[model samples]
Target: MMSTATAIQERSLLGLKHLSREDILAILDRASYWEQQSEKLVPILNKKFAVNMFFENSTRTRFSFEMAQKRLGVQVMNFTAAASSVEKGESIYDTVRTLESMGVDAGVVRLKPSGVLQELAQRVRIPLINAGDGNNEHPTQALLDLYTMRKVFGELQGLTVSIIGDIKHSRVARSNLWALQKLGAKVQFCAPSVMSAPELAEHAPYVSMEEALKADVVMMLRVQLERHSGGLFQSSEEYREQYGLTEERAASLLGHTIIMHPAPVNRNVEIDDAVVECDRSYIFRQMAHGVPVRMAVMERAMRD
Candidate 1:
């Protein structure tokens, strides 16, 4: 006979590949309960250890993981691009081998290039949660964002969601689209053709920002400076006029559309400052939920 924890333990949430629509709903149901009671709950991960191995510069995602782990009493080993020998010589696989030798348990990782997390998933027997991997996915961020949406609007099905900007270089864009589609939201992309998802992303991306903004939710992602291998556009001014969310455009769609951005936002480049601060905005809530959601991820991993 399986204990409740044992049932969850035998299940591995290694990838979206393993999750059904029902599985995601169950995770969300659990996350919502945790979000409400997290402050009252005793630290569960006390003495257990987790590691953060990031290959990028981040504010919300990195610190959120640390806070989440700490809140659960999980000891954390933090490593960034600068602090480690990743600067001089060692490969990522070698770096993980080194960490494994240190007795770290499960780790949450952020890296560049699509499919890198999949590679790491194979390499590490310990559960590896994907933070952000190039323009491929940010699973945890998507989870938090979806939780926010459900809290604000009550349901996702049939609601229009516009994910705007840098889709070609944003893991958030890809992950959000995946989650939104799975939950029955009508998802669309707003970007220059070059910055849009590749042909296989299903929906034909809108070249005109205005066309995509007619959504119940407008989610803007920051441009990925590090991954823009080529200048997607010739000039910032031209880019702003054509595709950027200007004040004029904001006023046009200003009423009830919930505006969101997965930080850090390139203000005036992808979104108008006023819109980001508007009452309709959920940017900060999205950031705030990061801690609880990551806590949920860590808890589930440890239970497994």
Candidate 2:
């Protein structure tokens, strides 16, 4: 039999823009299959080795990918920049090439630079999955978000999803905007003037917070304070008043409208604490769906 690592030598998942509508649906279908097989651990990736190389810090994306690998029976190596020679000025290309030389089948990479993942993809021979790349994209998160919505609504067409807050600094928002639009969902952006991006006007029109709340789905983005230099907002209190999903706002939404956040929630800043636990909130459920969606991605990436 061909070695497991060799089977995935030709595949890499860089971004949602690389996938077709049919490709997106097939991955979702695969995720559903994995979800149904939850209780049983299937070892389709037995004897394969994959590495998680996170140049950026993450909790959900990193651990979920690790969990998906373990559940699929793939041996995993975790690489952190601080712990690796990356701290000694080793380039990403050299580091990943070293992993490739070690016979790893695939790599899941999260980097802080926008186009670095694609650059690394070109240099590496094994399959490389982009976990998140700066403000460029987070394809897997978008896929899982879509999968979570599909579980609830059965279809994406005609559903309106309003993404509120920090649009200029969100990889999640960019990925979701592309995927949701391609899947026939109407998307809108709502954010403070400082946080809005000119590019967003091409994909979705900006709407008032009240107008945004009328959508079937409300996705609140955290204030990306780390990525911003300064002056995005004067105060968190003011941001909460204008853009936060307050308890009153959540309560006022239609019964069927749902709430979402790509998490690391800002408590009362981007979304009210109480609103996060409300019946309409599917934030945690979205985290739960990450494993299966990642499983589907890894399985397909490693397939012959």
Per-residue accuracy of model 2 over 1-304 as CA lDDT, tens digit each: 8754444443577888767899899999999999999465788898899999999999778999999998898999999997989989999999999999999989999999999887777667789998999999999999999999989999999999999999988899999998998999999999877788888798799999999999999999989555555776667887898889999999889889999999889999999888898888999999989999999999988765
lDDT of every model, 2 decimals: 0.75, 0.89
99-154: candidate 1 lDDT, tens digit per residue? 87788777778887677777766666567778787767788888888888988889
How does candidate 1 fare on TM-score? Answer: 0.88
As for candidate 1, its clashing pairs are none
Instruction: Report lDDT (Cα) of residue 81, candidate 2.
Output: 92
